[model samples]
Target chain A: MPEFTLWDIVRNLLLAARWTVALSFIAFLGGTVFGLLLLLMRLSGRRVLERLVGIYVQLFQGTPLLMQLFLLYFGLAVMGVNTSAWLAACVALTLYASAYLTEIWRGAVAAIPRGQWEASASLALSFGQQFRHIILPQALRIAVAPTVGFLVQVVKGTALASVIGFVELTKAGGMIANVTYEPMLTYACVAAMYFVLCFPISLYARALERKLA
Target chain B: MPLQLDFMSILVQWPLLLRGAAWTIALTAIATLLGGMLGIVCAWARAGGPRALRWLVGGYVEIIRNTPFIVQLFFIFFGLPELGIRLSPMTASILAMTVNLGAYATEILRAGIEATPRGQIEAAESLALTKAQVFTRVVLPPALKKVWPALVSQIVIVMLGSAVCGQISTEELSYATNLIQSRNFRAFETYIVGTLSYLGLAILVRNLLYWAGPRFLFGR
Candidate 1:
């Protein structure tokens, strides 16, 4: 057996980090689209549609993401669909992100003053025109900090994708530790990488929130 | 092959699921108590303590908050053993959970503490109350009351995170579900049961914390 060097471990982790970054982007982007649709349906003045979206959010938020991954992974298999960990992880994470992002965006929209909606209505603009031109821009300002902060959460959440056998950073660290018998170094590197990935966004969010306030 | 779902098969292993849920609750309870106390102390340190202590607490909060909880758990459970500080899975889970919650709760409590009016602290100081008395009697209760909802949500997040504790073989609900699935080849059903239990637990814990936050921690 060959000896494993520190650089080799770092290189392998860097390679795996690509998948982590990719998965995070997939989940975040997909979630934003879905979350926006849910936000619209929620604001559309249809009580049943609003309640349906509420249940969707509650279902996702009320359970562990781990279980969500498991359900998609095994649930897909049981339904006679061929499932890779990647597919299952992506689907599960997209739904999870949708749930959270919708709620966060909804809160931001709700923060807007009531007068603006009334003003838009009086201007004879359709609901879509009012929302598109007047509402989303303002809500987007409030939503930016929190949504970026939530991206950090989504990145961290992709670590759960590892449990289903997607070889992301955390899983790769575990694999490396198994081979090198150096879990301390491997996991320390893993934590540092995550910190590097998350801390700047966390800081930016804080700064933006402060500026906004 | 036709798909046949059997919920009854997984339901038969209720004992394991119950035990797993119990461990999860126990882990959360212990972590909540210890981590909540740590949060208070750290919040106090950061808010009113010396400069060095404040920086120290701030660093601790940032480091823990930025990293994922699962990695932290793995580090404590898997990494610590290499340093000659071996801990049982249960001990490591509790330690990891407490440290994780402590970091988050510190920030939450700090926000609350910072919101405390300057006048109130000054008034307490003018009363000749000791610093400790001023914090505990004058500062903490109202701060806690103000942030109880946020703190409760954090605790619930921590509780849901306990699902990962089973990765270390601590036999939490997810672990029990995994074991039953392996035994009976009812993976989907087992997970469904586990997920529902977690959902129930989350709701139950949130209600419990909301109810207890005022009655026990602060006056209603």
Candidate 2:
């Protein structure tokens, strides 16, 4: 059994923390891009397109991320596709984040009010021009607090990637704990890192909520 | 090159898949009952507890909310035993889920509690209802009802989260998906099955809650 020092465990977890950050950024950024496009499609008046996006959101939102990851990772492997855990984790999270983001932004856009849309229409603003000029700016403001709040969720959700064998902070902590046979000390350090990463975002979310209010 | 995949083969593993689904449902049911009660208590304490108690509750919520559930599970599963308190993986996972969901439920229910009109509490007091009686009959019922929708949605969230317990080999749906995929080489189909089953579960849980709401709420 490997006896662990406080500094040793902390150091390993801190090193793993970088991957957590990297994964969060990748998932958030990628999810946001996909989410924004989905938001647009959802609002498009074409009933088929809107319904398609609606089902997309519901499907991703409705399922557990863990099962989705398994489906992507083990399921792909069974198909002889031979995907890496990294790719699978990223794709699963990106899709997961996008569903929530799409819903969040759609609400923000809808919050812009019918009057504003009518005003933009009267001004001869094309859909692109209206959205690019009038609606998106306002929607972005409304979207900020919620978007930041959802980032906290995306960060927490990334921990689930450990199931697919991606060695991020939580996964690394598990490995360290198994080797040392000390769960609390390793997990305390794990929780601490997550706190250090997440508390600022939580506080910032509150601050934004206050500022917006 | 053309590749033909046979998902039909994996269907032979029906008994195993059904067992996996059973465990998942059991896990969901246990966690929901325990977490619901635990959450209601947490919600009450956070809303009305003393200053120190409030700090404790708030801290618990913040720590659990910030950290990953997997870490929490690992901590309880392995760590508690060293302190002479042992738990099986399923027990530990359910405990973790309850505590985690309890925190969020407290937040949700606290919002509902705060939303109660001040006049209503004063009215209850004036009517000579004991404080405990008032909380049970008047305060908690309506407060929970007001936030019932959000609370149930959070429950679904936790139900979905239960799949992560597969890492510890809980033989839940995710665990079953891994089993079928490895055995049949029908990775995509296995996932598709898992996804569809999970989605169905989510819907079923939500519908069950809604259908049973009036019965539970009004005791009809």
Worst 10 residues of 1 chain A by lDDT: A204-213
TM-score for all predictions? 0.98, 0.95
Per-residue CA lDDT of candidate 2, range B7-80, in tens?
67777887887888888888888887888787778877888889888899899989988887777887787778
Screening candidate 2 with a backbone cut-off below 3 angstroms (N, C-alpha, C), the clashing residue pairs are A75-B187
- Relative to the real complex, the DockQ score for model 2 comes to 0.73
For every candidate, what share of the true interface contacts is present? 0.87, 0.83
Chain A TM-score, prediction 2:
0.96
Q: Write model 2 residue lDDT over A155-204, tens digit each, in one string.
A: 88888888779999988988998887778888888888888888899989
How many Å off is the CA of B50 in candidate 1? 2.0
Docking class of 2: medium
Model 2 chain B is weakest, by summed lDDT over 10 consecutive residues, at: B211-220
Which residue pairs in candidate 1 have backbone atoms (N, alpha carbon, C) closer than 3 angstroms, thus clashing? none
Relative to the true structure, candidate 2 reaches a TM of 0.95
